[model samples]
Target chain A: DQQVKQNSPSLSVQEGRISILNCDYTNSMFDYFLWYKKYPAEGPTFLISISSIKDKNEDGRFTVFLNKSAKHLSLHIVPSQPGDSAVYFCAAKRRGIQGAQKLVFGQGTRLTINP
Target chain B: EPEVTQTPSHQVTQMGQEVILRCVPISNHLYFYWYRQILGQKVEFLVSFYNNEISEKSEIFDDQFSVERPDGSNFTLKIRSTKLEDSAMYFCASSGDAYNEQFFGPGTRLTVL
Candidate 1:
């Protein structure tokens, strides 16, 4: 099922530039959105997350913007560093009971930072 | 920081053979889950366990699959009969509460011949 989609299969950015990665979802029931970075042979590492009630959430150099009306979200990293080079995945989950809920993930986008 | 961990980094089994993947989630997390990712596909949810029972499961978690928490610190996923399509990376994750983000283990790559 293609509930969540990351259209960009790959992205390249130079050091000190802003890197923007976009994602879109077709499910309106999804109330939570998260961005994760994954390295080869490693599990996804959480970067940031935003609830549907909010439009934006920022953590240090990373910021996530959400637009409910368009069902779109984007992650922005300023002054991109080499360490940020990895595969990025966008995931969404529906609101449910007080327990672990299933997450729908998008096809990952490989981000490459060039020095 | 405490984190989730998985054993048997890689496993290879013949088709129809039984295999069990083990995991040790974060010490305080109450919710545990199993997810798998094929070589070129997005991660798919398998099942979620809580209070010694399965709280949720996806369509992919068919009759051949089972999950157990036999001990205090261990969670396991067992496949009674493996198939070629069962070759994938299995991940274990845990969340402290309903609102907290789930932490994932490194994953175990299972190859069914």
Candidate 2:
């Protein structure tokens, strides 16, 4: 059941620095990759997503880079802020029967931004 | 900014008791799903519902588990017999379409004593 994996369990960065979080997947059938941020006692919130057809997708301070050949994807947040400190999860979507799809999530990396 | 919502933020039930976790998907969304996460574990998909029927289910969604959309706005996950391993955070999500990002509701923490 380890189709998606975020090897880093925790990451720390200072304010105004770039924060990079990496994820890897073993399943090639995944059609989309997404990054989710979660806080304690809360559900995951989608931040950004990239389609398999593209190599990069960016939204404001967040950018996601995908390398299909290596089966790896990474999220970069420039000038990371304290508010960005939370558990970050990488997820992959695969289409299922009847067009229903499900997201497979990683173990999550706890990102801590120090002021 | 319509968002998914869930009820009963926390529930504690005795083993073997039945429990139902309720969720209200975003309005105009047609697809719904249930996922759960045990402490320190990855979120696992339980089932996906579409067109009033279960479109897909994972192995973890065994005979004891079921999902229903009894009303227009409400989706629910019911467990016939709660077990110790059933204690986890159950999340509900919905999407306007099948391939896009699915909005998630604040999870309901279920504890089977």
lDDT of every model, 2 decimals: 0.93, 0.95
lDDT of 2 by residue, A1-115 (tens): 8999999999999999999999999998887999999999999999999998999999999999999999999999998999999999999987433464989999999999999
Residue pairs with backbone atoms closer than 3 Å in model 2 (clashes): none
Worst ten in a row by lDDT for model 1 chain A: A94-103
For model 1, state the Cα shift of residue B56 in Å: 0.9
lDDT (10s digit) by residue, model 2, range B1-113: 89999989999999999999999999999999999999989999999999999988999999999999999999999999999999999999999888888889999999999
DockQ of 1: 0.63
Off by over 4 Å in 2: A95-100
Task: State candidate 2's DockQ.
Answer: 0.70
In the range A1-115, model 1's lDDT, one tens digit per residue, is 9999999999999988999999999999899999989998888888999999999999999999999999999999997999999999999997564544877899999999999
What local lDDT does model 1 show for residue B6? 94
True lDDT of residue A61, candidate 2? 99
